[model samples]
Target: MRFKNKVVVVTGASQNTGVAIAKRFLEEGSKVLINSNVKDDLQEVYKELSVHYKDSVMQYVADISDEAQVSAMFKALDEAYGRIDILVNNACHQGIGPTFEEIPTSFFWNVLQVNLQGTFMMSQQAVSRMLKQENKGVIVNMGSNVSKRAIHNRAAYVASKSGIDGLTKAMAIDLGPKGIRVNTVAPGYIFTNRWEVLDEAIKERRRTNIPLGVEAYGKDIADAVLFLASDEAKVINGSRLVVDGGCSAQHMPIDVDF
Candidate 1:
């Protein structure tokens, strides 16, 4: 248990990659506070995790975009765990569908509010708490490969994730002297419950684009996050760890026959 006795906070911990990150941390013996905007979703995940983790897992419901709510969540964490050793900023607004020209202005702003502003606020609170502790802390932002390579119909998401890359670098430099490390985990084409609905042909066609011949699972991304948060990555900071099954390395999709 690399994280034994460590206190962790994972935003967007109710589903998909977020849930996976929280579970991995808990398994490694961290006292984790799981946050989600949906009360029911948070409770459901809490119920499942609490069954095994019991005292080590706690759940908090809040919209990360709201500054007050974000502060309240941290306050609750302070009361529960007293200190935070790692924070995984995994909550995000995907901003899927609709071309840039066709997308509504309100929808675009909402995406930024949750994806960019929310991360900013969450990290700010985490840093404040970390500053008071003797051990310092680590902040792992959930980024995307699309941040480096744009994807169709996800303008807001791409923009927000790209901003996270820049933010991670800036935070690393600013916090390094204070003993805080910051990094980004950029995952490409992660397989989640959403992919379960896609037809077999559609899934196969998607996998063809990846050189590894398989999409990343939530566990895959979780492993990267855990590594960055561990002592093993002591000097690693401001780096973007792409967990994309080599998707970003190729110029074009591999021709199966070639």
Candidate 2:
């Protein structure tokens, strides 16, 4: 119950990594507001989670890319909870593959709008609200190891994630004065539903690089997010915690000597 009494807002919690993180937080005793743009099934996901947390989670359907919706979501949070404690910017459109020239210019803009701009907007709003309160808060940006190591056919995602590193540092510096800690949790090739869409050969190659001999799970990333949100990481700001099973530490194309 490290996050007991904490009010948390987790974007993109309909499924995948975001859902895992929100569930973990709920297990740790935090009141969570989970959001997803798809309104139809969002409540279903919330209700499913309710079986585990039982009324500790609320569902908010808002497109994080839209400033109005974003504002309304946070405002809703304030109205319901009266204050903010921990914010996890986990909403993102995984714009995989497609080079700049191959995809439409709008595609690039849309990716930036969701991944980079949305993250910036959420952090700013959360910080503004947190500043009004006497207690400090934590903002954990969901980043990818691809920010440091780029893979083939993921130009937009790579660029957005790399930008997250800069955004994380800048936000940390600007908000540190207000006692708002900002950091990123960069996961490398976690086995999500999205992973199934990747090429088999690529997955095999990634597995070979992982020192742990297996792919990292979404729960692993969730645990890391929980730690960063906890008092244990009270001093960990502007840092990128890479939870990749040491994937980033290995050099690709190493000669396998028999």
Candidate 3:
């Protein structure tokens, strides 16, 4: 029960990594608030585990990119739980797959608006509430290994994640004195449900890119977040923890071998 009695808010909790994080927190004794920009009947998901951890989980619907919605979310948190001890910025627009030159500025900004801007806003709001408390809190920003290396056709995502790295450092510096810790979890090649639609050839290529011979799972990233949010990481802050399966360890071949 590393997070016993803690209140954790995870954005984009409808599925994938977000759901994994929420489930992990509940297992570790944290009261979780799951958020999604779009709400759906989570009955099946809830049904599977709600019996095991009843009342430890709750759901909230909000657009993290919208200031008003974010503000309202925190307000509701204050009203419902009185304080939030953990916040996971996980919601992001998986921008259209297109080259930078072919992508529109609107599409670019929209991605930033949700990814980078939303991260900043949520951290700001969470910090404000955390400051009012005697005990400090934690904020985990989801970054990407691609943030450190530019990937083709993912300009907006890479840019936003890179921005998250900067945001994490700055927030850590500013909030450290106030007892709040901010950090980032950067993962590479995490295979989620979305990958199920990919052809076998593409899957093989993905495996090849990872030196570890396998892709990361949602639980892998969720475990990292749980550690960072726990007292075990009391000294860890402003750090970018890369959970890549060694995918970011090598450079591409300059030329194909004959």
Candidate 4:
């Protein structure tokens, strides 16, 4: 119960990594605020979590990219929880296309507006609210291995994640003296909703990219965030912890023969 009595806000908690992060916090004795824009998914997850956590878990549905909605959500948090100790910016958007040039302009902008700008908007509100409260706060932004390397076709995603990492560093330096900590956890090849319906052949091929023979799970990413938000990482700030199962360590694929 490292986070016992702490109030946490996890953006994009409708499903996948968001749900995992929220669940982990609840298990660690934290009061969690789950946020997501998807109505049906949000309601479903809220009901499921409400069963286990009851009054400890709260749901706030708002698109992080929308300033008015973000403000309203924070206001609601203030009214309900009174204090926020940790914030996990786990929401993201990635537009699919074969090449950058072929991608639509609207798609490219949408990716940045949500993935990059949304991160900034949420952090701003969290920091402001934290300053007024005791214990300050901690923020963990979700980054990706695609940002480290120029992964193919996901130019917008790679760019936004890379930008978020940069934002993490900037926030850390500015907020450290203010008693707030900021960091990023970059995960590679985490198996989520997108891969749920993928063919076995595709899954096997995806595994080939990861040197560890298996991809990361949503829990792996959540565990990392929990550590960063805990007191154990008090001195740790402005760090980008890569939880990719050594995927980022590979420079070239090596042939294995029995």
lDDT of 1 by residue, 1-258 (tens): 899999999999999999999999999999999999999989999999999999999999999999999999999998998999999999989999899999898988889999889999999999998999999999999999999789999998899999999999999999999999999999999898889999999999989889888999999999999999999999999999999989889877776546
lDDT sort, best first: 1, 4, 2, 3
Candidate 3 lDDT tens digits, 1-258? 788899989988888898899899999898887888776634445555578877777777788889999998888888779998999999878885889889898889999999999999998898888999888799999999989888889899889999999999999999988899999999988888889999999888778667787888999999999888888899998999999988677676212221
Q: lDDT tens digits, residues 1-258, model 4?
A: 799989999998999999999999999999999999998899999999999899899888899989999999999999998889999999889656759878888888889989889999999999998998878999999998888887789898988999998999999999999999999999988888899899999889778767888998989999999999999999999999999978789886444421
Q: Which residue runs of candidate 3 sit more than 4 Å off their true CA positions?
A: 41-49, 253-258
**Candidate closest to the true structure, highest lDDT:** 1
Assess candidate 3 and give its TM-score to the true structure: 0.94
State each model's CA lDDT, in order: 0.94, 0.88, 0.87, 0.91
In candidate 2, stretches whose alpha carbon ends up further than 4 angstroms from where it belongs are 196-202, 253-258
Candidate 4 segments exceeding 4 Å error: 255-258
My TM-score estimates for the predictions, one after another, are 0.98, 0.94, 0.94, 0.96
Candidate with better TM-score, 1 vs 4: 1
Clashes of 2: 1
Query: What local lDDT score does residue 94 receive in model 1, on the 0 to 100 scale?
Result: 94
